[model samples]
Target: MFCSTELAARLEGVDTELIIAGSAAAAARRPGGDGFTIPIAGGVAAFAEEGSPLDKVAGLGFAGVPEPAELDAIEARYAERKTPVQVELAHLADPALAELFTGRGYRLVNFENVLGRTLHDDPATVRPAGIEIRPSDDSEFDLWIDIAAEGFANPDTQGVASHEEFPRDILANAMRDITAAAGVQRFLALRDGETAGCASMRISRGVAQLTGATTRPAHRRHGIQSALLATRLGLAKAAGCDIAVITTQPGSKSQQNAQRSGFDLLYTRAILVKD
Candidate 1:
């Protein structure tokens, strides 16, 4: 059910491997993403892009890597790129089947090391910084986009802001409409009256998504990101969210911050390229 770019983005610059949904594979490489695509197996396939010809898990065989002919079949049907991709075998997948993956030079990057926690029980603590937190309004869209571009990453790049544009930018901007109508808050942190960082969250249906936290290069070591995060946690608790779900890089400064702020690591999803 996962998209290839989604997996690739999470893995980031590691370049180990990427798994993908066939739909995303069909979309030509996204300039700032994994650059490869894979296909989904079931219901969520509806969400996958149309016209992908990749096979489902069953047809591909949960037993092991497919036979040479079968693998050739997947390659024939999967036409978005020339790169090879791997099918992730879940923990429950038969061991014999998993060996096929191992035999084919595909290594399982165990993601269990990543963790998550519920925010409902977290106690907020005040931390000191010369940061001022305020709401992000439509008028500040440029600042918002700039901050996102500055904080988010682009595949195959160095330095945070040195990244390129991302596909999620379009999707995220669309969701802002829903949050805007509900008075869900998006906050910006400023150092000495200039924007230093930004974070946004929405408490809805008892779920608080700690989304979009960023710190400008000049603002690092100043506690701007942490303050914004703590503020978000307080907001979630005040609004009565039962849990917060954050899916960031398995290990990054942002991911560590989330874990430290009472967030727990959930199992990870991956994207892998076989060849």
Candidate 2:
């Protein structure tokens, strides 16, 4: 029998592991800082390019309650790397993990809301007219990366923009690494033959995670993002995924669009950082 809790746990585990794997892959293509993984209390911490914008320990989760010894070990690992310890904690994670981080001087830095919806046979039926979504090709890779970078650079979006100029080389390298190793499916959204946005889907453990959904600033409010979401969901369904998930900042335009597209709020995850 498939229990809801069991399913949630499974999804959470795979989601974190996938992030770790993707980060390590991207770090390998960089010049310095070899990405590595450390066994933590109940999960794993993946360290990527130290000091780079992409650098962080991902998938920091602990099973049940964590002891002080476990917290010490985790901190020691990050200290050895000379990088601040950062953890993105899922809402469904053990409550003790948050308490331990708070007790250890870790501050909450980001809050991300996870949304999900069951995949239907014709998930793209809701796609807006005049917008076309298709699998991205090698020739379109640069454009896709550029669009994504621009979208993320918007002040309205979360996260600090490292540089005003697009980090083209880094973005290209990371995209190549992730595409080769993460089983990611990239899609480009076009409005009447012009590139409007980009989205990606990574399927694992019978679930499809929608990520990197972004629209060019000039293309906002035209339903491009919602159309991309529908297209990705359709693709995931066709690929045999039972459910599709996405994450966004709470109460943001992205979250509003997601809710309008029939996705329900699953939980909100927090990013904890120790400097």
- Using TM-score as the measure, the top candidate is 2
| Candidate 1 lowest-lDDT run of ten | 42-51
- What is the total number of backbone clashes in candidate 2? 0
Model 1 misplaced stretches (Cα beyond 4 Å): 1-115, 153-185, 273-275
How well does candidate 2 score on lDDT at residue 168? 59
Instruction: Give the range of the ten consecutive residues with the poorest summed lDDT in model 2.
Output: 157-166
**TM-score for all predictions?**
0.55, 0.86
In the range 1-275, model 2's lDDT, one tens digit per residue, is 12254555666766666656667786676557557666554556666554433445444453566567866876787788787877778767777777878988998877777788887556746567778988997788889888888887763553432222336566666667667777888899998888988988899888998866888888888889888887788778888988888877777788888878778888777878987
* lDDT (Cα, 0-100) at 41 in candidate 2: 46
* TM-score, cand. 2: 0.86
How big is the positional error of residue 123 in model 2, measured in Å on the Cα after superposition?
Answer: 2.1
Q: Per-residue error at 75 for model 2, in Å?
A: 2.7
Query: Top lDDT: which candidate number?
Result: 2
